[model samples]
Target: MREKNHVRNVNNRNEMEAVGDYYLNNKTLGKGEMKMEAAMKMRIADIGDEIVSNKGIKGKVEMVKENSVIIEILENLSDREYVNNRTVVSHKNYVII
Candidate 1:
């Protein structure tokens, strides 16, 4: 039983280290620097459409593309909004819901 517990702890530690490595290798910026474009996903909260605001939509980036991202939005209703690629920084901190 003690050996089994020790092995489980080691496995957990290894999993955590792997997660840390992925974040360190993939993270784009140092403190206060603008995020790398490759590291960002399209956010529905950043869209200029009123519908996004009304539905309180929040999104997670599923995939990034050359000019856009595929995102999964969490909201009560569904709709599409077009956002300018350059305007994301202005809305990065907005509360989606």
Candidate 2:
């Protein structure tokens, strides 16, 4: 019984470590899609929040030439702007938050 408990503990620790490693790698590699997914999953304002790309971390529209909004992203430190109302090309590094 003691041996079985030890094995279970090890397995639990391994699973925890795997989850930690996955988050660490993704955080370092700067996956834009992952960041966008996380942002979209957040319940900041409310459900059915209008997703717009303009000049803010979260905007109501994508493109506003006047007074461009800038949001500082923790992950994916790429120099890119989210233009409102534009379809993003796949495999490109742009934050659609």
Candidate 3:
């Protein structure tokens, strides 16, 4: 059964590779057909809200930018070098605590 499944998987992979090659040779991706996948909506951290950095340090949201935020470190877990005032942090860089 395992051998049969493996054979089927190989056949499917070969078929996919052939389709990929054909598409590579013929550059015709239809308009609006290749739309971006759903992305996580970024919720900007509000002022005074506590946040934790990816490095495990706690901070507060000082200001919101166009695509980032200004975080002021309020708590530190380790002696790691922290980002200064001007360091812009994006939504993915921190989590609201």
Candidate 4:
């Protein structure tokens, strides 16, 4: 699976809390009727939690945002200089482990 993380702008999400009520955006809701989507409860992912990305990369949750979590990539698979091992992964792109 493609990793839909936004590591391109890691510094931009420095203000999100490390834990709290995490909400889902339209992407996370996926394809569904509007009414049912609106009535769904939010998912929770706290700091220190382990999550695996859609691409199968494991990470430790460092911060929690409105619709994503800042994670320290557990596996160093990228060879690029900017990977940094930290990225913002959408709630829908990863599963808590």
Whole-model Cα lDDT per candidate?
A: 0.28, 0.27, 0.45, 0.53
lDDT rank order? 4, 3, 1, 2
Using TM-score as the measure, the top candidate is 4
lDDT of 1 by residue, 5-79 (tens): 111122221121111012123332222232232125325432333212112233444444544434455332213
- TM-scores of the candidates in the order shown: 0.23, 0.17, 0.48, 0.50
lDDT of 3 by residue, 1-97 (tens): 1121111122221121111111111332221221110013235689887755444456778898778788786665434665564345677655454
Q: Which portions of model 3 miss their true places by more than 4 Å?
A: 1-42, 83-87
Per-residue lDDT tens digits for candidate 4, residues 32-75, read: 43224323523557999876554445679999998899999776
Residue 83: error of model 2 in Å?
Answer: 33
Cα lDDT of candidate 2 equals 0.27
lDDT of model 1 at position 69: 39
Root-mean-square deviation per candidate: 14.9, 15.0, 16.5, 12.4
Error of 3 at 78 (Å): 4.4
Ranking of candidates on TM-score, top first? 4, 3, 1, 2
Per-residue lDDT of 92 in model 1: 40
- Name the weakest run of 10 consecutive residues (lDDT summed) in model 1: 13-22
lDDT by residue for model 2 over 1-97, one digit each (tens)? 1121111122221121111112222232123544454455433322222332211122233232222323222222123554443332211212232
Q: Say which prediction, candidate 2 or candidate 4, comes out ahead on TM-score.
A: 4
